[model samples]
Target: MRNTETIPAELSTLAACQEELVSITQCAEAGISKHAVLRLVRAGAWVRITRGVYDTNPVPVRDRICADYHDHVRRRAAWIGLLAYPDGAATGGCALALLGVGGLPSELAPEVSRPTWMDAGVRPGTVLRRYGTFPVVQRHGRDVAELVHALAQGLLTLPRDHAVAAICDALREDRICLADLGRIRSLIRGRRGVVAVRAWLELVPGRDASPSETFTRLSLIDHGVPPDGQQIVFRLGGTFLGRVDFAWILPDGRYVVLEVDGREFHSGNGMLADDATRQNGLVGTDRVIVLRFPAPRDSADGDIGGQVAERLHPLGWVPGGSIGPVVHLD
Candidate 1:
């Protein structure tokens, strides 16, 4: 009599999950009985991840496992969800960044999305959702949702500022076009956790070159002073001045240039020298006021809007004004 206990995990088909993990039921469906699973564990070929989930390796070790154990658990939980709903896919930031769909690095919790309802409650470090109207497909051997679906989910889950940065990151990468963002706004309309995302979309001005630019622009608008031109080029009598990230045409016919300095682009001597040269070009007797705000890595922690407001307040920028005096560079 052939013993199922002697069966190996490698040869089991139904037990095969995307990340070398599977549930006992999946093994059973693949002709691998509970005894076979036990045999694999005894042989150190599989390890019990959770109550039902099992890893192919008895002692699976990866670089990520040490750095962040939550990340490891997150991936395992996602596989468990996938075991039941094979059609569903990993959603939110984790999947979006991993799949290159346009999101910040998935530093937050692990989140997955199913087209239909899911049976599991929220697992530790995992946020599951039954959301968005997107076809789930297998990408890179793992289920993934449409870019828009993932993007919207990101906006819904991440903190308000983080969500704005995530959408802006996707926008910078061209992973989702401007029109598609509008489409996402419509698709996620009336959905839970859609209000903040919707409000941000309405506030974000077009033509932002980077996440910092978007964040800074949104801050100004939120502060009640909308910027006039984004990524606007300035020329002083055929001499090309740098294009500012956020700009305002002041009431006195001078321009206020807000140069958002993100560490990646504005750090180091080369960039500093270049920035100084550009600022010099934009300054002088002309009423061109330049305000340099070193943008924060995370918008949530940054008080750039308040700083801008404080700098501009002395120059007569109120909550509802078309233009104000040149914002002080100091």
Candidate 2:
């Protein structure tokens, strides 16, 4: 009989063999045959994952463990340049995990290999592909240092910013709210090449922004402009006057409408003439003040808040304070 207690606890746990590998050696030490180890392997009570590497039936060989083995082989091959691989071909993120960067996804099997490159040592067909030089390379920060090269490789294969923009546009079209974007921003906040992500978010106008309007009224609120009602319908004596972007009603029963002019609203001659006629009608009432902001670009300019403040001051609209170029939301 072999003494299994001779094996270390950590080794025994790692090997998980009922009759430990050390016990087999002990049997040999005691002049017993090595056939007992072979018998255990043949009985399906132990598995040989690799040469000299064995695991008991209770401890399964997971896919990640196998991937790590594959990674080691690829790294060794790459160090010697045995494989003819492409330059700048690396894997990162989930793709890196596929290439055995930090292990495969929990649910995935390790057998499905994808193409990946990392410092020219990555094994091919590990889910990271080398697509020449179409993807852009940007420095990835410390948070994702291990996956930076891979992400750069992937991005190089794709169009610059186009892939990211398409993803953002898809999310926007799906009406995915700002909170979801905020969460994503938080995750990749300090990462390298994240500027593209921020640019994507900027391009996707929020629900509060009007069509063809570059700057949102919500953005205006951040500049110290008081919260104004949106798409407000102006009325006089129960008759519909017109719809205004924002409106303010004073304590003295006076009203002020801030008309935000965009190309869509004041484009052709017909629309401009119609808008003039509407303004004339409103002025005829003598109970309302009309402040017009021509061109959407004006509001986005640096001096917009001051311009707005100057216009509103005489109409009993007081300035809260020095308004910065930040948007405030409730």
Candidate 3:
């Protein structure tokens, strides 16, 4: 029979308390009894967060304690295999925790609670009502369900997509601010059901009009290109021309627009024809200098920022001050 003495010691060191239970049972042939578990709990070596659930160490604060409680509730609910609920109960503060957005006040932490049936009578604590469907993904060889739960009771609201977009948009606006990105990245990097996390990161819209536009914008921002408004509109000869994705005005009555060429915006022959007509209109007024940037995804040698700066520097638009690289907030 495997020794049971080493099991509690192993569980104490785990990063996530939920994962430690598996090791506890696996270490003994007959499995550890409730009495033994209780002994560990009474000794203060473990914490009985809820019925049949144990946290090996003291939880830091109210939020963590609540999270542990919800985790316990969810595990209990899942073990009984109840119907009408998602496979996994979402823990409180999950929405903010998962997306990595900030702005939560400290006092609000106590309000978040776990989702459970009415009869569970678990303290309402700060559990937020469910908003959307949970997406399932595999992690660490197990099926885990992903869903949003309130942080700080209902003191702070975390909407799934909006929260994600907010973080992504914030990152794009100021690449140096990465605390939120770093925090969320660390939480989800190895967690279960993080496919949604990956998809959110890859598709979340940046400040640029398109993904290609972002590539150029990043290059320019990082390489000291002059700042330009994205999607800037102008009028020529009393006719309103459509907004250009990136625009910089020159002192010589000339305007430069960096058009990051990509299939999404220029895929069909009709789009190509429309683009040509627009270029001609701008050229006729002698008011525009369109610089086409090679799609970075397709061109290995292209440097969109470098190319834009090279063309515009002679025309009087110059880079100023140092800007930092994109930072993932976590």
- TM-scores, each model vs. reference: 0.68, 0.39, 0.40
Quick one: ranking by TM-score, best first?
A: 1, 3, 2
lDDT of 2 by residue, 14-44 (tens): 2322222223433344443546556656766
Better of 2 and 3 by TM-score: 3
Best prediction by TM-score = 1
Q: Which 10 consecutive positions of candidate 3 have the poorest summed lDDT?
A: 321-330
Q: Which rank order by lDDT, best down to worst? A: 1, 3, 2
lDDT of each: 0.64, 0.41, 0.45
RMSD of 2: 20.2
- How does candidate 1 fare on TM-score? 0.68
Please identify model 1 stretches exceeding 4 Å from their true place.
1-87, 101-106, 115-123, 195-197, 318-330
What does candidate 1's lDDT look like per residue over 1-330, in tens digits? 223254455545434334567767667766778877777777666776555567765554444345445444444545655554455577766565545432253344546666666576544434568774575556546677666777677777766665676677677776777787777788778888676568876644366677667667667766766676667777665667777787766455667678988756788999999999988878863668898877655443377777767767677653433332223332
Window of ten residues with lowest summed lDDT in model 2: 103-112
